[model samples]
Target: MRANRMPPAAMQCRPHTGEALSMAASDARSGRLGFNRLQRRPARDRYDGLARFFHWTFAACIVYASVAGYTLTRLANGPVHHFLSQLNMSIGTVLIVLFPFRAGWKLVRAEPRAMHGVSARQQLLAHGVHGVLYLTMFAVLASGFLMVPNGYTFLGLFEIHTPFQKGPLTDALFAVHRASCALLAGLVVLHVLAVVKHQWIARNDVLRRML
Candidate 1:
């Protein structure tokens, strides 16, 4: 090629031209190149203290309750079986109380930072789904208490009789107890799917908040 008509060096590109213009404008506006002035803000929040505590404790309680429930199902009549069934009922009542505390705390507390590039619509959906989850958790616990035939007692400390005297109320509560469990399971799956999508598909930090 002729010297006057020669193309620019192979290293030159449109992106470089744009970057050079940006830096020049930045320098002119602020008297310095701020390109390297990036700040490392700490990852804001995994969860509030209350939410974290609730998550772990609820996991433990669920494991215990499930085991106790499974054990109760296998035995026909025995001291051990009755005791376990009673213990499970007692623990379920505690969960009924604690679920609300955890959920109410979430309502008042600000959630942790969302993953990078997560849209505002996604964030709003996250919050709305979580609200449904909280309500479902509460309903599950509440119905479980009402479904128990013998009510709940803890180490013989006290007794809280089932409010339903029988008939339709108890039957409905029992149905609700079963239905709420299915709802809760679906919610858990959705929450997990979202995290998997963010991690594997979106390559975001959604799971890092928990980690």
Candidate 2:
């Protein structure tokens, strides 16, 4: 007896639709694997190697710098404030040294997959915002270092040399740093809005890919 099979009329076939999986698909997958790259990292649930490092490193620096900025802008000049300021300044100085390699990794590595459902325009806008974010992040980090009074020395193995000798120039840098921080905050809000729009409003997993 012949094996049973669908008749020619009933047989279903797939057409060559040219459409590839959207970026969203890849993004979703990235979130699943904890990394956007094909190679999986050691930690599950934690981000990929690059993302994990960047996320925590940047977080530490941002927290230090932001706290320092607020304190410096408000403090009444005292010992406690001075000590905190020095620590904050030190953290920012470290960020300045590390920022280059962090940025270089971003530049060289393939980016996480984009969400699939968005339009080309949306994707392009996302790309632009990301680029601006990176540039501004570096600028802010550098400005934080430049804003330090007296001079900055590295916390690494050796006692690093001073970058500046006076406070006025550094203070001017602080002003610029403060202004830039405000702008960066604004941009961050906008970015969050865009992301929420895509994920919450659209009921999509666009944000998941990057998580």
Task: Please list all clashing residue pairs in model 1, or write none if there are none.
Answer: none
Q: State each model's CA lDDT, in order.
A: 0.76, 0.69
Error of 2 at 130 (Å): 1.6
User: Each model's TM-score, in the order given?
Assistant: 0.67, 0.66
Best by lDDT: 1
88-188, model 2: which lDDT tens digit per residue? 76677667777788878877765555555878898898889878988888778777666655564454334445577666887788788888888777777
Error of 2 at 36 (Å): 21
Our model 2 lands, by Cα RMSD against the true structure, at 13.1
* Local error of candidate 2 at residue 137 (angstroms): 1.8
Clashes of 2: 2
Total clashing pairs in model 1 = 0
